[model samples]
Target: MTQKKSPQGGTFKKFIVVMVIILIIALGFTGLNYYLKYFGPNVTGKQEYLYIHTGASFNDVFKTIKDEGIVKDSTTFYWSAQNMNYVNRVKPGRYHLHEGMSNRKLINMLASGTQEPVTLSFHDLRQKEQFAGFVAKKIEPDSASIIHLLDSAAYLQQYGFTPDNVYTMFLPNSYQLYWNTTPEKFFKRMYANYEKFWTPARKAKAAAINLDPIKVSILASLVDAEALHDDEMPTIAGLYLNRLNKGMKLESDPTVIFAENDFTIHRVLTRYLSINSPYNTYLHTGLPPGPIMMPSVNAVNAVLDYQKNDYIYMCAKEDFSGYHNFATNIADHLANAHKYQQALNERNIKR
Candidate 1:
């Protein structure tokens, strides 16, 4: 009779204990899901890919890559890549990183032996020989072979480039391409880019100015190096245009400086200014043999947009803020020169 009076409260207590056990199990599973998605590293292993890029953040790379009908899961990728120290491994260039690349897989791809490549950057290149040399250094091309091709008219004609014609083939812009791109293919791409930029409209405008496109590009290179201000581009372009029209020497100090290649000149002495190098516009009456540097598109365009005027002489003002004095007569030019010289003296700038 007393056993029958067992409290219903005990039964409720038993149910409560079971429920607590179930909740703990469910919570454990949830926590594991979170850890795998966010905390686990090395999610992918041994997957090959075409490429990754330098400066690409952990998130950006995962977003761009495509897989077989399913992209890599971003949540898993970021955590895994980060944990495996895959940051800062992206290089520039076109790559064919293989499928299912692990963190180790990707890191190995960026190693020196990795076939993946970054974009090609030309650093302050001045001559065709320099470009050829850079190509040789970066790629597997023999320097002698490329140099021979550069010097050979017949060989270059296949690439639509004439011998000694640096202006028609390469533009000073970065190109992203496959690492294994052949030299012939590289030049083809470079030439195509060159043609695409120098449209017929540009050619006709160049002719209308009575300036040879090649020669104007040569002068534009010089003006680009000399003019510090974007606004000064056309004015400097026009100054050279005027000098060319009036049959006067360019008399650009930058040209003389480039010829000297050393900034140690206490001053541009009459002798140094009169140096006989082809780049010395003070020596020759016109533009140099070719561009002194790969010119920007703006500088090249300025040669076509050169304003017509009687200004045959120009000199930078003492302020050095990119403004210049334009002079049509020798007296005004001399006076401007005197003022600039005085400023130089006061500032104690060695020439």
Candidate 2:
């Protein structure tokens, strides 16, 4: 049998061995390429965030990623995206980009729509327009869109608020929200938070003071403007409540300044009081129609738990301590006012 070994058989055996070796080499090369394209580091550069706008096409998204120079090799990313079917599954959102991210990881993230939430926060925003601007900076909606909603009486009315009092709905705090949240949705979320803040206990307190939640916020704005110290808020609130109970004018300098729309006026004058705006508490014998500024929670709570006192008038202290001198009678208030006026004159704050 050894002498009869067929030459054809040996040639066939050698061919099979050669084919096996070629197949092994081809598979090794293919696997290496696949590993490099899918699992290897693709994302590069210092850019840390990617904002894919709504209705963005896959091509548009890829262009943004490429333009940001976030990927080390565009060709590998393109290949991986095509193979992984991410080209058809692109999701629009704000994504957190990281350096040295693998193609597989990035592709998975983009397709899954797992976005990084933005931390939205604001404090002491003076105007509805200003609040809109703050929100626009963190979200996809422009300031104009948010402002339009804020000023829309019909739209605001659905939330049980007029355009003037609608600004009271937003409570100052940090909120985790998506960057692409619509204006209406944003307003609803803020209103929900406002509702949560005005709990049963808080509402009961507001009722005890003969003020509604919005009225409490309105008065809180005044208290916040008047008191330089948190400890003094209850006292200042008490004085305002006393005036309200007696049907006396608020006569708050802050409200006068608000009426004049002059935030720069540090020293409100008798001339400012002549501005016949409803916000001019000197002319209007009650709380203003709206908040002059977004009051803090502490200020709102202060109004709810206002101290009981008979203080009908208050004048700023002459010492510039940001504290006020309280008085129950006109004569005592006049004396304190005269001293404060003297201090103001010394400082040349005539306006």
Candidate 3:
């Protein structure tokens, strides 16, 4: 309608449209790239965990990732980590790797220190060294470090424990703890649990039995070693208490075995009783200086609620039924011992 469109103006309009299309394409590509980098799957399909040690540097973490092949694209992960500022916020812990996890999520977890806890359960551990080794397997501290603290008399004085008796503080149970917990913190947590377990009611029961909490635990260890059946715990505990009351030696075969540090002995021999160690109950009166093994809650409770009985002796039944024959006189105990010895001889279990 108007005058014929100017050629120059028409060309300028076409140029403007082409520029807009190019800009849109570039923007779209950039947005797609960013979305893929930030939100796309980066973790590998292999199910595994990342253990970042305490005091680990970001470089160490990155090296572990590369070595373990935890991520599909290391370049993208490194870029994402830098962008998220996770390089400086590295937290040591145990992190679970999920298949198809994005770098953003992984970085966020590591930065926030949202780590999975280790569920630690132990029982029948016989020595502090063994317990330390077992705990070290689940946590960050090495067995040597843990043993150092356990053996430190000055350090354990605050917790009312000695190197010999410290083993009693670790009650056998499942505990939830971070894998990066230090050795000192682990001991503190265990002491807190030990205190919690010795409630007012339990303390009162222990007092009634003329035993403090530590003594109760030491006796409980003996009870646990002697009784293979839980139902027999109270009776065995009662028998031991009777012997204690009579000022007689505990004469626990388990104590002798522990003194000799020979767990392979099926039948405790006469010679094993002569071991000069303080743990030899047949030679040393009262409970041993420490627990022969980690005491179970059942064993501890059995000691607290021991049956009132006059039985002062116990010998394993000859039937191999894991039960004991109780007696109030030496003659009856000798008879039971004879039967058990005969059974052992028949089985050729001399040790």
> Weakest 10 consecutive residues, lDDT, candidate 2?
41-50
Whole-model Cα lDDT of every candidate shown, in order: 0.68, 0.91, 0.93
Model 2 Cα lDDT, one tens digit per residue, 172-239: 89999999888988988999999999999999999998889999999999999898899999999999
* Model 1, runs deviating above 4 Å: 1-117, 129-148, 151-154, 157-168, 263-267
Candidate ranking under TM-score, highest first, comes to 3, 2, 1
- Which candidate tops TM-score? 3
Cα RMSD for predicted model 3: 1.3
Candidate 3 local lDDT, 170-222, one digit each (tens): 99999999999999889889999999999999999999989999999999999
lDDT of 1 at 343: 84
TM-score of each: 0.64, 0.95, 0.97
Q: What is the lDDT of residue 88 in candidate 3?
A: 95
Higher lDDT: candidate 2 or 3? 3
